[model samples]
Target: MSFKTKEKEAVGVPISESWEIDFQDDFDTFNTENWQDQRIWVNNETHCYVPDNKYGTREVSDGTLKLKVINTGAQKPCDNFDKNGVQHPDTQYVAGRITTKNKHEFIKGKWTARLRLSSNGEPSMFPAWWLLGAENNESPVQEANENVCWPLTGSGEIDIFEHHGDHQKNHYTTGAIKSLGECDKGDWWSLRKGFDVSLNEYHEYSVEWENSDLVYRVDAKEVYRNVGQGDQYPEKMFAILNFAKITDAPMKGEWVMEVAWVKHEFRK
Candidate 1:
């Protein structure tokens, strides 16, 4: 359980290239300069994404951001809509989802997030720290440039860490989403792979562009590699952290994913 600690402005030691920190947010009171609450629907998820700590979903306390999925015991109106332009119906469950979209975006470099789950894997919980193409034509489209659909036309995907609570307790999936060269199509399982880690303790999950490869890491160890898949994700991408209720399985209590920090760097 190696914690990244409070080195919020840390410029990590690099080998071949001198990496320079370009964007960072330590959750020191939820920096609006680096993030925004993103509400959108996809993946046929069960819960609705909410903003501003509603239902105690996105709380920043003690220098960490807690993304929680709370069962409200009643359905409520939701604003999240899908690509087909269908608004999410009233959902009894709600959770937090935030992104660096429209604020911080970068092309090929490195992305890192220090985080940990509050409990071991449980059915229906889906929490992820990942990157999305800036051109993704989802909800909250802030610009006309965001007209491209996901995993297509350089609107690619990269999962730094994604935990499916239905699986093994200390395991998570990571890697790229291979595009099918078509609209709204991406291969979710081909390039992705799962690995085990200390689920309830802080760890730095990261990815980097190493020439023609996309390297995935747990803390500092290379656990998986998407060989030569770097060419699929040349466009700028934004960071996202969210906790989702994916099924109708009864939630025991509070489900949380605590994030310490998120940052990006480029070779200098």
Candidate 2:
């Protein structure tokens, strides 16, 4: 794996600049080394592993991470597996979702990931690039179960991106901040007209944050922005790349999420 950093100034915004982290895993060098480092704590404690149900397994082949939602009957364990081998049936088919806990945490910065989303005759496939918090208090079970302690009303969550296959050409991304015993929120956007169904090409989705502001983008174009919105924004949060299933959808199906890389950079 090779790491390349590039800095460029935005064409129209004179003071605005951007930096990119390029990881060309042409030889799968980073698969075992850096990939493990990027796994987030939230996913780890939640038993989110590869090749599960909605989430699956991702293999490093041909210089890219091929995320497949497969149904092999092997009982995959959560990040914290016990010796009893007691399987969490609720977490079956949970695969291919990675977070940034038990490793590094970012306070405020820009995060972007490149991916190719696909559907496999499965109707409820949801491929998303979003952000969620790491429940870092009390027992792992209590932390994951917001209703048991924090309650859903006060639990903080910031979903930067979410798109479903059923909503062809109409996807929305959300952001939420919990404070004052309440959760403040922002409106969603309707940006989904330029997607190609071939599912073989790459697309970049990014979220930029600074202080109490945030901007979400697709294919490098700004889609949603919140200024003075959602409880001063998320100071420290982790991003997620997942292809999930819509349990309530009329038709049920499966999907795969393939990714090139996820990059993060700060403005100076």
My TM-score estimates for the predictions, one after another, are: 0.93, 0.62
Q: Scored by Cα lDDT, where does model 2 land? A: 0.48
**Compared with the true structure, what per-residue lDDT tens digits does model 1 show for residues 1-268?**
1243223225554343667899888888988888999888888888888877759999999999999999899889988998898988899889999999999999989999999999968999899999989998887789989988877954788999999989889899998989898887788998999988888999999999999999998887999999998887889999899999888889988899999999899987
Error of 1 at 150 (Å): 1.4
Which prediction has the highest lDDT against the true structure?
Answer: 1
Show the lowest summed lDDT stretch of 10 residues, model 1.
1-10
Error of 1 at 135 (Å): 0.9
**Over 4 Å off in model 1, which ranges?**
1-16
> How far in Å is the alpha carbon of 144 misplaced in model 2?
15
TM-score of 2: 0.62
